[model samples]
Target chain A: MLVTVVGNYPKIPNLPRPARLRNAFARLDRGQITPEELAKVEDEVTIEVLKEQADAGVELLTDGQVRWFDEQTYIAGKLGGVEINGLIRFFDTNTYYREPIINGPVAWREPILIRDYAFARDNASRPVKPVLTGPYTLARLCRNDHYSSFEDVAFGLAEALNAEAKALAAEDPPLIQFNEPAITRHPEDARLAESIWRRLLSGLSGETAVSFYFGPPGDAVAAALNAGFTTVGVDTTIPGVLDAIAAGPKPPKLAAGIMDSRTTRLEDVDVLAGHVEAAAALAGSDNLYVNPNIGLEFLPREQAQAKLVRLVEGVNKARGGAK
Target chain B: MSKGLLTTSVGSFGKPPYLAKARSDHAAGRISAEDLDKLTRQATQEIIDLQVELGLDILVHGEMERGDMVAYFAEHFPGMSIGGLVRSYGNRYYHKPVIHNELRWDGPYTVDMWKYAQSLTDRPVKGMLTGPYTMVDWAFEEYYPSRRDAVLAMARVVREETLALQDAGARYIQIDEPAASVRFDDIDLAAEAMGIVTEGVTAKTITHICYGDFAPVYDQLIRIPVDQFDLEMANSGYDLLDVMREKGFDKEVGLGVLDVHTHKVETVEEVVAGIKRALEFMPPERIYVDPDCGLKTRTWEESADKIRVMVEAVRRVKAEYAIE
Candidate 1:
């Protein structure tokens, strides 16, 4: 249970393009590249990104999310009745596409494409964690365009996403991590969120470990435990988060988020190591994982590489101490 | 009516038990929109009284009815759809609105609220609006083919609202564009977009920029047509005052002498030193003291202490200069 660095990288572009052209491509409703062409571009980008992550000596590596624009949009594409819509402005010049508005009778669109992405990442290395956006977060953030209520939409999304998770599990990856940053937004939706998580995990087959990231663990922790998942991820850098996770069921693996990804300031290895140590103390050293809280998409390439290097070195040092 | 010290609007407020109950009742179908509006009015009155108790020069309606600064505008405006999830600092999440159609403001976005607060007090009330650049920067622009077009459309809607506020007897209007610094790479484009959005608003206008480096955008900010510029300085330790002095910015400068994002109340001496340092760059008359941004992120107690320290610091600076 020694703390291991989980795989997830932010979007890093190799060359600079005109910002206008980039924005145009991002928001283009029709014309230009087809979905297959976009997938081809993403596959090429993922290959190069996998090499970068592998070179950095990260044990688990993501395809740098080249396949999807953001974490949720990728998951939304597979869910039935979710139509990807226009681009919205996100914090200061950043923008992401709206996840498809879930219309009536949400169901899987026949054999969700988890195997396609898992096979893509598998080309890079072994034990790749196929990432999925959690059902609760997708439902909470998305407009209930045609759904009668949030709970109804959430349950449908859960069923759709769980089908994808089971499909990915068939590929036999080491784990499947769901990015559920939206869970922290609606504390009132905790019960429904927990139910969604429980249903998804209960339906998943095989030894696929499920993890969450970006916000507080919320009632999803209990849901994950009740569903008998192995690891629960928590952003430890946020105040009062670790305490909340500690209050949950015992002996669950903790993906302790120790690195800051939003700002330009690089984490001092010793300081980050101290956070890992603290997390280990709280949740047994055997049950801890060192990770950056969220994606590194906001960071420059040089900074992202530097942060990853420092993280790997810090984790190795902390693990040695644990041994 | 006595003139008061300058103040700017910040989002978020402690929803008291009564307000919470009112909101719950409204949600549970026990109250109508009119009833909720009345409750919100009562809360605004109470907030204005608190501002008077603190002896501040300016006042705001505390944005009691709004869930967030930008979301309030989106709910009222047409052609805006919310998309994507944004994490606000810790675990707080905001669903950013996407502009899907041609943008237009129907009329008088916040005039009723602004007028209501102003009517209650002789003291000047600052009208608050989120700037065009910030609205464009903070939301997901799914409908617009380009970011520049999206921003221009957003500015048009904001300009309409700004003019309406001026017509409604707003003396000072604060357009918060905290995202300005984040778009520093495209300052000229931001300036152009902001220029269009702020057109024809003759009232005294102030633009606030915070949460990032200021040196790069300092010159660009000065070029904007606003009367005053509000910036976050205390957090940056007045690191860019030299740049301001070198540029010789003549307009009124709102020096953020208090940190608003944290709970730690800055000492009076710290606030005074920050102001004194800024005074060396600009005249005391041209300088206004305020917190870095809105005190909404902070607890009410911390916000109060920070404001108290800020006023005391201003008084100390004024006494030293022997001005009032």
Candidate 2:
């Protein structure tokens, strides 16, 4: 079984000293340094987190999302029609994200995350996956003043993000994962979510995945599978979610979210192996990807790194037990 | 000027340079606890003097004695351990605490600070404590069987702290529940915990909820068993005021006049416009002018400048209304 992480990792490491990211931003705010200088700090942290993940035995890596401020506005703000607003709580987490106000037609002029992807790929030893906030989730999270309807907003974002996805695909990464945590919360929008994902992945040559988290998968699992994503990432920590994913139309690959990323507590290898085995039973071992239920941004740097170590061990234990 | 439309801060003020250095040195073990405490008290005195100088109606101790709102209470509570860092926002992080066992209130935590702050001034110092819901929401839960159980347990702990503050002659106590407005589905749980927290508390209870889309929880939030609902108005462009006007605010409001998250000190006209917008919904007596949230995020100079502008705006509005 392959062990990977869902999107973000903690940018700051566990240390007695303050994070360089914080200090750099503070310095930038004081006009002591240029934006280029601050970007250099972010790049350093990104490489650090990438190395940490690679060392912990994670095969597939994300940039740890060190460059992006938050899930919504990081991409949404880069879009033509959107303007970043004041802080709002990002879902149920204690952390906050800048809200995006959709003022004009939501259009992506250029590649938003392509540079970060290229940088991570260049810096890391292991293969890196480009992740984006799903168009539907972005539309749902932001205020849509311009769109006449939800469909108008979601489709507009999808067309824009689709162009960006194609741009990232040109770099020929291992996979591109669109994190649609908002879909799990509002499963009634499953159809719209599926349609948007299809639009986002349209004409893209590389492998793609859609992950649902922050809530139970509900009916969104089947919706994503039907949307023709190469992989469907499900949060199996929610009761009966594993069974629900198994019950749904299995995709080419299954990203089994067995680990809880929100808490600092680590899971036992045996328990994790059991989860992995169950996941492998549904999607053959070759097609299964084991990961946390969501992003590791909620966790401390030490715990997040430790969880990945345990994850690798669990995957190994599962393979060993099968042998 | 009338005491109506009184000026007050939500909770924390930005820590001054000396206090900030002292906290860092204390954390690094370079300074003794006594040294840190001395500086903290000195900083608190400075904050009180600043607020007094600014001609504010109510004042805060500036929270120099504590770190993050949640971690400070977690340090005092039994069965809790302050854990590693998690980002609160852009480049801002706090050590999220872990509830490892059944929680218990060892003794009063905020009473001493509240007493000290109150003693420094004749003005009624708002006794501040992180609300039980916010503490539970912010921290990593490892002990409680359910969130509801943890929330209620924390509510009891906070209630004890509240009563202690009340007993210590605190007339105004602000229980900060910033996390309450985050989840609309769990607003009942938040409200229920607040009920437990304020049970038999005689002081004028206030709960400050900020930074989220609170429109869904506004009705339930208004009924959160507090005397006043302190909210952030200017940060979100005073859009929340429309929601409050439609919902009909029955209780007093700690109206946030300036955005604390940004360094751009709001102009007197900008603040007056916000307060006037609020005045359209609620009377001046029901409105208490303040910043959007805690000024802890801003630099000390930024916080002071923002407060000066806030006070000036309130002064102009009070003068215009002749309410006092």
Candidate 3:
């Protein structure tokens, strides 16, 4: 059985200088500080966050997504014709920054500006998994102002992302996973989803995997398989997700998310092992990959790190590795 | 705004004869959306008639058209996709939707429907809206360069809808933002984002904040520009109100004295005591009797009984306060 700690890097502590600056920026939003000083604080925090993730045990570390407010909008800024909008109260909780629809011809403005951060992560002990939000999810989430359908904007975004993925793949990372949690929503609209994935994977140069979470697998799995992806990820917690594996032709390794990421209830290692065992039985141990069900963005720093430690340990034990 | 009577919601109070018929018709494909709307209208009218008979002040349309208050909005908005399939705390499974673009109202969203309901009765009709923050937070959000920007756009869309309701002569607008308590860690951001949505509304704005620990957000809650605060007090055992009293809350309080989740119909005396207990913290005039949240989850009988008791309780309290 193959076990891996898949998903975004765990949040890291702030560097003394940049920590002060990020705090200052937080204060600016609170009206405790002025907007004029925000730029200086952002730069400082970005540098410190990048450096901290590089030092952490994250195998596929990112810039901790510190520069952008959220995942989709950050990628939208890289592609042409995409404009981001203000924060909105999301859920009964806090605010989320969202991307407005693209209203013009979409194109890549420049190579994604992750070089400084990528260089930092590359120097770390573990190989990084260059992360990109899947084109389908992005298309489905943002307004398609300029394009006729979500697919049109998605295809354009996939091309832009593929260009960046190709450049990042040249950096010799072990894998690149495209995050597409939104694919699980449209089980009925599988053909449209498959086409988008086909185009997105076509843009990448090397061995790449596409991962999804928050829900069960969909027709996108078959699309990823058809696109010759090396791995296809799915959240195993949802109903019928395991059946999705049975439905598709087994071509790539399956990144089976067995750990619960949304709730604070800690999973017993034995229970986790049972889930992994079931996934391995279905996909075969050689094809199964272990991970949490979704991203840990909502979890507090301590809780997320603790959950990861438990997850990594449980997966290793399930794979019959001596912990 | 009177103190003599209590209020109850329609459709949710008791097991209406139409519920079984509607469910059967829906399963058999014999009932269309228009049919369902008609059934809801009739059910709402019956509830209004019951409230009038009970002599309650405020009347609700029983949230007839809505499935889930926040989730329903996702179905209408463009550039939004439901992400994951998960069961809510109430055992109701909802596909979590994600906002994918700049949100804009296509036409009059809820106004026409509410206006139609309002036209049916001479009683003051309360127009309910899910707060912009709750709509954004409950759904999967598209990533943005600026979180604040995305929130502002959502708020603008909400503001447009709210203003339209006011223009349609809605005297009372209830913006349900139950998710506000959960986002305590990001209270300031939430306040800023919601501030944009609530700008320039002349109607009696009453915000319903429920479900989570309100202690963390109480101070911030007071700062929100609204006329009244409808809170989940009965379900939470009134600890939140005590916290608010300690924080020196002086605004109008929508005291949710009835528990709409359970089938147990509270007595008029119990309802009176619940209100009287609340009066220890604030004056009776500053209080409005209501259920903690919507009674959509409860059966029609339970909803009616709960409201009946609430109204009786208000009468008892009013009589006692008058005697004093």
Candidate 4:
């Protein structure tokens, strides 16, 4: 059984350079630091987080998103004709995202996450799956001033992200994870979400996984997962997800997120194994992969690391990977 | 000026094109330090005169020097350093403050800016500071043992500046705590921290809280020792007024009659209708008129027009009531 992270590990707090790298970015803006120095600092942070995930026995490793400001904004900032606009509270977290404003036709004029993924893959012992904020989530989150409709903006974003995804796939990464957290927010926009999801994962290499968290999606998540993807990344930590998963069609691969990501409170190992077992029963053991319900950036570093160890162990125990 | 409805902004104004150019040029090192300061001072003076002409009872320095509300403090203040940009909501972003050491007063932060603006206008200028709870809430905390510890430490640091601003002859000291609304379970901790920050201060203390649901913490919020509550009423369409009526908010309420988030300016009629709904719960004398939040997101024209419409609406209300 494969146990991987959804995306984003907790930040290494109290750095002497800048407690958070966002402040480091500010210093760079003031010309206190050179672009080379900033890139070096970012890579150092990436190494620490990537090692932490690998140490915790995370089968499919992530870059830990150490350089990421939040889910959508960091990648959105790099795209052409997109403006990083106002400060906004990022959903329910204490963290905030610089909201993206689409000013013109969105396309990948330059490579965004290729370096981040390449850097992570080199440092990691396990195969790293580069995580991208999905087109649907990005379009949903940003103010689409340029695009005619939500559909137009979403597809526009899809075309841009499709470029980045294709670039990462070319690097021979085992998989690509698209975090469509917006799917849970506007579940009513299911058809719009599915169309965008299809476009995002149209021709990517290896296993392609689209995940939802914060809440359950309507029918679009299930339809899209079954249509063309290796995994259905469901946050079973939420109340309605089990019912949603049981009621709907199953994907070829099921990434059941049985661990809580928001709080530091540790889930009982037996209870976590039980959750894994139930999901496996539905999807069958071969199809099941275990993970946290969402990103663990909200939790403190130690707690997040401990939770990772537990999630991997619990999934292994349930799948009978250990003696 | 005190007789009729008091009019002011929630503090920031949109930076004009020239000022924006100067800021970028300074950062890019294309301009000298003296050149940047001269341009900023000019912008500040222009806004001060503009506020007076707009007939606002209270005047602000227009915050031409500030990049973001939280970042401005984090940069100037000691014990904090400006971090990279984090997303706020929509397309907006601000640098989250990083507090690695114990917070110190660091001489005077906003005092010089406050004094500069006060000298420009005869009207009482607000010595604005992002409150201790918000400082603690928004920043990445590493030194403190608990969030409560971090906040109280920040409160003491803020209190030093508050007293300094009072010494500078500022009457209205607006300590904004927009982050307080986010913490529902620990609302009391935030309130207690605010109390600690404002403890033994003589300046008229006003706290502005917004963006989150106030229904859950309505019971704990009213008891905080502040002379006024500058709330985001227009965004919620005066829904908080009903809560104030139910739970009894005795402090003077800054009725945010204008929405600053969008470019669509509120008509004078829309402003009056909102205040009319608010008047049903709050007395006009106890009301202060302003926008829902800072106008940094909006264009200069939009910000100016919204304030003018708000002031006009308040004028109509005062005339109808036959107040002096």
Considering every candidate listed, which one attains the maximal lDDT? Answer: 2
Q: How far out, in Å, is residue A70 in model 3?
A: 28
Please provide, for model 4 over A163-277, each residue's C-alpha lDDT reduced to its tens digit, 9 standing for 90 to 100. Answer: 8888878888777888888777677888777777778877775788888887776785665774476777888877777777788777788888999876455777888888888
Kindly list the per-residue Cα lDDT of model 1 for residues B135-180, writing each as its tens digit: 8666655567677887788888888888888888998888887777
TM-score of 4: 0.63
Alpha carbon deviation, residue A314, candidate 2 (Å):
3.5
- Which ten contiguous residues of candidate 4 chain B have the minimum total lDDT? B84-93
- Candidate 1: deviation at residue B46, Å? 1.3
Best by DockQ: 2
- lDDT per residue (tens digit) for residues B233-281 in model 3: 7766777777877889878878888766556777777667778777887
Off by over 4 Å in 1: A1-323, B1-13, B24-30, B84-86
lDDT (10s digit) by residue, model 1, range A1-323: 33233444544333342222233345444566665665565566667667766676666666666545555566787666877764433334343445467766777776655655665656786345677667777776677778778888888888887877877777777777776666665566667676777777776655444555545667766766676667777677777877777777763677777876654456677877778888888878766667777776555455567777787777777777877
Instruction: Please report, in order, the local distance difference test score of every candidate based on alpha carbons.
Output: 0.69, 0.87, 0.67, 0.80
* lDDT for residue B27 in candidate 4, whole number 0-100: 88
Off by over 4 Å in 3: A1-290, A293-323, B1-30, B81-84, B89-92
Lowest lDDT 10-residue stretch of candidate 4 chain A: A12-21
Candidate 1, TM-score vs. the true structure?
A: 0.54
- Score residue A62 of candidate 2 by CA lDDT: 93
B222-312, model 2: which lDDT tens digit per residue? Answer: 8799999898888788898899888788899988888887878889999999988988868888999998888888887788898899888
Which candidate model has the greater DockQ, 2 or 3? 2
